[model samples]
Target: MTVEHREAAAQRQEAGAGGPQAAPGRRRVALLFPGQGAQQPGMALGLYRADPRFAARVDEVLALWGAEGRAVRRDWLAPDAPDVPLDDLRRAQPLLFAVDWALGRTVLDWGVRPDALLGHSVGEVAAAALAGVLTLAEAAAVMADRVHHLASAPPGGMLAVAGAPEQVAGLLGEGVVVGAVNGPRQVVVAGAEAPLAAAEARLRAAGLNTRRARTLSAFHSPVVAPAAALGLPVLRSVALRPPRLALHSGYTGGLLDAATAVDPGFWAGQPAAPVLFGPALDGLLAEGRWLLVEAGPAQGLTMLAKRHRAVASGDSAAVALLPARPGDDGREAAAAAAVRDRLAAEALLPV
Candidate 1:
C-alpha cells in the first residue's frame, strides 16, 4: 500500500473511544452532514413531501426555540431561496442547521437509523442533535448564539487546501492551521488574512493547490479563539449528552465521552483545533461496510465521501458521482430515491 494509505490505516487503529453501535442485524451506516456554505434556497422541500413528520419536527423545534417567527417565507419554500434574507450569518447558521436537521430526522422517521453521525464545521451542531447529544431546539439556540458571538470577533477566513496534511501544515507555520480534512487532500485552513495569505503563498511555492472557501469568517482556527473564549457562558448553558451513536469529534477522529464531549472547553478549543474528517472516515471504514448518507441540503459531504471511497478502493472506475442541481425538484427526488435504493442494495437498512 502507499504511504498515505498506511497512515490512514494507522489512524483507523488509533481512533479509540467507543460510542454506541447500531442494533443487531442492522448494517453499519453513517449519516454525514455539510456545514456552512452548503445552504441553498428551499432546503427542506424534499423532506417536506417525502415525510410529513420532517416539517412537524422542525416546527416543534422552531416553537421550542422561539424562532417560529422567522419561518422560511412562503415564496422561499421552492427549491431555491437565493433571494431570501439568509445573507446574515446569524440567520444563516440556524436556518442551515434546521434544514440539515430536517433531513436527518426524516431519515430516522422513515426507519433509516445510522450507526454513527458526523457533521462538518457548522454541521457538527446538527450532528450533535442527531446523536441525541443536543435537542433540536437547543442546537438551534446554541448555533444562533454562536453566530452572534462570532460576528463581534475580529475578521478571519478559511481556505481549502488540496494537499496532504503534513505538507499543508508545513506550509502554515505560525498562525494558520488545518480546519477540516474533508478528504485525503481536500483540507481547509483558517487564520487571519495576513497569515492565510502567507500560507497560501508558501503552498503555491511548493506547487500545492489551494482554493479560497466561501466562508466569510475564519472558524476552527485560532482566529475564533477570542470569540469562542468569550462565549463560554452560552456554551455552558446548553445541556449536552453523551452521543448515543459514534459521533466522531471534529477536533479529533477519536470518539468523545460524556465528560469531555459536553464540556464548554472542548467546544471553545474546537475553533483552534484541526478537523479530522479523513481520519474519522477511516475509523468508520475500519469497522465494516458503510453506505454514507449526506443528511443535509448540499452534496459537499457526498462529494467528500466519493473522494474517500475512491482513495480507499484505489479504483476510480468503481466510483460514482451524484450531483445535485439547483432548483430542481425532480433531481432532488431522484437523488433521494437513489440513496434509498443504494441503502437497500447494500443491505444497510433493517430488514
Candidate 2:
C-alpha cells in the first residue's frame, strides 16, 4: 500500500484504541520543532553557551558521521553569512537538526522531559533523536543522507495559506496538496510551480492570505515522490528504536510507537504526504495544556502554537518558544527561569 494508505490505517488503529487519553497531570508538555524556513543565522547560541557540552555532543556525532561540524557552527555563529545560502537543503537540514537537538538537550538539562514530541518537515529527524528513537549520530547521518538525496533533484518549493485545510484542498485541486495545518487558519500547500501558483491564486480569490516558503523542495506533495523513493532505503537502513517518550506521528494524527515508526517506508512516505498537524494538534490539546516548546531554529512553530491556542478552547496553558540560537545575552538564564517559574506556578516541578 502507499504511505498515505498505510498512515491512514495506522491512524484508524490508534483511534480504535479509545477516545483521546488525558494527561495524568501537568508533567506533560509537547516539544514542537520548526522546519526549514525557521533557520536563521546565530540561532542556538544561547543553548551552546549555557552548555558548551551541547555543541560538543553535536561535534562527536558529526565526527562519527564524517561530517564537518564547522559548517553548522558557522551558521549558528554568523547567521547572516553573505556567501552561504542558508536555505540549501544539504546545509539547511543538518544545521537545523543540530540546533534543535542542542536546544532539546538544554531543556533536558533543566529537568524538563517532554511527554511528547512533534516536528515539522525536516525537524522530524531531530525529534526522532530527542525521543530516543535514534542516537544523535544516527539522526545526523540519516538527515544528511536524506538531504543529499533531495539535493539531487531540481529545486522545488512550498507555499503557505491561511485558511481551513479542506478549503485549501478544494482550492488547490489536482497538483497542490495540504502540506501542514500549523494552526486553524495556517496551512501549507505544495506542488509543481504552476500548480502552486494556481493554488495561491485560488486561495487569494477565496480571501485567504498566502506566503511562499523558503524550501527548495516541494515537500509533502507528489513532486517529491522521486526523492522519497530514493530516500526510502536510507531511512530503512537507519535503526529506529523505541522512543523514551510518546511521539506524535506527522504523517498521521496519532500517538506513534517505535515499532510502527521503524518501517523505513513510513519515514520515506512523509516527504510526499501532507503533515497531519491539525488533527495532531487536536490530539495534543485533548491531553492537557501543553507548554508547546519550539526547540528548533526559528519561532515559526511557536507562531503556529499561538494561533492554535487562540482558536482551540481549553488550551489556555501558556506556550513558550525558547531561543534556539546560541550566544550569551541572558537568554539562557531567562528561558530557564521562565521554565522554572511556569513549572512552579503550575506545581509541575519543585521551585
Candidate 3:
C-alpha cells in the first residue's frame, strides 16, 4: 500500500478514543450498509433531524447533485411522500447513498472507530467512499450517472427466492438470470419484466417463497449490460484509490484490493454482476470477533448477519442504527440512541 493508503488504515484502526488499543479485548467494530431492498418510506428522517452532524454530512453528499439534491431532500422529508417512492431508481439511489454515507460518517465523528466497512449492492458505494477508495463527489456523480443511463435498459425487476440458489438459478429463462446470492437459502433472479415475472411464477410453483425487491431497474444481471457499458467512461474518470480501511466488497466477495479498487471496468460491471453478500460477510466475520453496526435504513443487514455462525454462536453481534418500521421519527431518534448506548456499554463507542 502507498503512504496515503497506510494513513487511511491508521485512521480507521486507530482513530479517536475507541481505537483498538483504547480498550483491551473490546470487539472490533465493522459498519454494515444495506443495499437497495432495505429502502422504505421516511427512513432515517428521525436520525437526520436528531443528529446535526448526520444531517450536514447528508446535505453535503446531496449537494453534489445540485438542484436534484434539493428535490431529493425535500421529497425525503415530506411526510406525504409517495407510497413507494423508494423504488424509483432516481430517488432511491441518491437518497440511500446520502443516508448510508452520512450515518456511517457521523458515527466516526463520535469517535467509534471501525475496523472494517461492508456494504451490500449500492451500499457498497457508500462503503467505498468511507474506506477512502473514492471521494463523496465521485460517488455521487457515479450514482447519478447510474440512475440516468440505466433508464435505457428495458424495464426489469428482481425476484427474491428462498430455499437455495440452485433452485432459483435452475428456474431462470434466457432473458432472466441469477442476480444475487444473499445467503445460504436466499437468492434473487433479475430480468426484464415479463421474463422475471415468469421466473417468479416458476419459483412459486416449486414451493419457494418469493418477493420482488423494491427496484424498477433489475441490477446484478445481464439486462443492466447496456447501462454498465454506457457508464464505463464516467466510472473510469473518477480517481479511485486504495482503501484506507478494511473493505469487504460484495462485488468481489472478499477484501477489496488495490488492483480491483482502481479498475473502472470492475466498478462499472457491478450492475451486471451477482452480489455475493453472503460470501463477503463470511470472509469478514471469519477474520475476528466483530460488532456489525448497520448504518443504513432498516435492520436488514443486521438480520442477515445474525444468520451467520459467528453471530449465532455469540462470538459477534449486530445492531441497526435505524428501525425496521416506518411510522414515527421521534421513536426512530430514540432507537438510534439506544443502540449507541449499547455500543458504548460494549466499549465500541469512544471512551
Candidate 4:
C-alpha cells in the first residue's frame, strides 16, 4: 500500500480498538509547526522562565550556532530587549526553527507525544529534526544555510488572500505564484514586488479580504530557485534517518514517502515549492481525529488548521503552544496554562 493508504489503515486499526462505541479519547494526536510569519519576539518567554526543561531545550538549540546563536537567544528571550530585525527572512528562519524545535521538545517532555507530525514551510525542518530524521545541529545548519542563500535573492513578498484556490490562481499573472493553499477560502500568493502588489490590489478591489504576510522575500516562488539550488549541498551533507513518527509533507500535501523524507533534493526544493498545507492537513485528519497542537511562536497555523472540515466538524481540536501575540506581561503563562488544561480535558494529558 502507498504511505497514505498504510497510514489510513493504521489509523483505522487504532480507532477500532474501542469499536464504534469508542470514546473520543481514542483518537490520535498531531503536532504542527508553523512556518514564517508566525514568529514574534519574546515568544514562549513565560515558558522559558517557568519551565527549566523548555529553557534548556531552547538553550541547547542556540548552542548549535555557537556564540552568535547564544547572542540571538539572549536578545530573543530578554524581557526588555529591543526589537530585533526578525522581519529579515535570513534571521527569522533560524530563530523560528530553534523556537519551534525547542517548544516541540518541551511538549514531548511534558508527556504529550504526537502520533503524527506536520509542518508548514520552514517549520518542516524542525519537524524533521524532532521526528529523528535530522539532528538538531543538522536542522540548525540547514536552516542557517537556507537563510544565507535566500537572503541573496531579489526582494519579493507574500500575501494571504481570503478566497478559493481557483480564485487566487486566476490572479497569478507572470511572476506571481500560489505559495500555499491554507484552506478552502485561504490561499497565499507570492512573487516579485510588482506582481505581488498588483495581485493584492486586485484581490482587495474585488472585495476579497487580504493581508500582506511579513516576509522579506517571496518564498515558494521561482525567485528563490537559485537559493534552493545553493542550499541543496547543505541538505545533502546532513545525515538522515527514518522518522520515528509519521511525518506529513507540506510540499506534497500528503504523508511523506520514507525515501523522499530523507532525500537532500526534496529538502532543497521545498523552499521554492508551493506549500499544499490544506491538502496535507486533510490527509492527516483522514487518519483519525487529532488534537492539533501548534508548536510555534504564534497561532497562525493553529487558526488555519481550525478551518479544516474535520476541525470544523469537531473531529479534532487545535491549540497554539505560545501566545498569539507579544506584549502582554502574562500572556504566555496564561496560554500555556490554557493548553495544559485543554489537553487534560481532552484526555490528551493526565488530569
- Top candidate on TM-score is 3
Tens digits of per-residue lDDT for model 3 on 189-277? 88999988888888888889998888988888988888778888998898989887788899888777779999998888887899999
Evaluated at residue 95, the lDDT of candidate 1 is 65
TM value for model 1: 0.80
Q: What value of lDDT does candidate 1 attain over all alpha carbons?
A: 0.67
Q: What's the C-alpha lDDT at position 315 in model 3?
A: 91
lDDT of 2 by residue, 1-351 (tens): 345435643564475422233335444457777677786656656656665666675566556546355665565467666345777776677777776776667667666656678877777777888777888877776777677677776566789887877777888878778888776677888887877888788889988999998777788877877877787776677777866666777667766755677777877777777887767766666654566776765567766666665324544453444554444687855665676677667655423
Q: Please provide TM-scores, in order, for all candidate models, with all chains considered together.
A: 0.80, 0.83, 0.92, 0.91
Clashes (N, CA, C under 3 Å) per candidate: 3, 12, 0, 0
Best by lDDT: 3
In order of lDDT, best first, we have 3, 4, 2, 1
Q: Kindly report which residue stretches of model 4 are placed more than 4 angstroms away from their true locations once superposed.
A: 1-3, 7-25, 78-84
**Which candidate, 1 or 4, would have the higher TM-score against the true structure?**
4
Candidate 4 residue-wise lDDT, 154-184, digit = tens: 9999999989989878876889989999888
Q: Which RMSD values do the candidates have, in order?
A: 5.5, 5.4, 3.8, 3.4
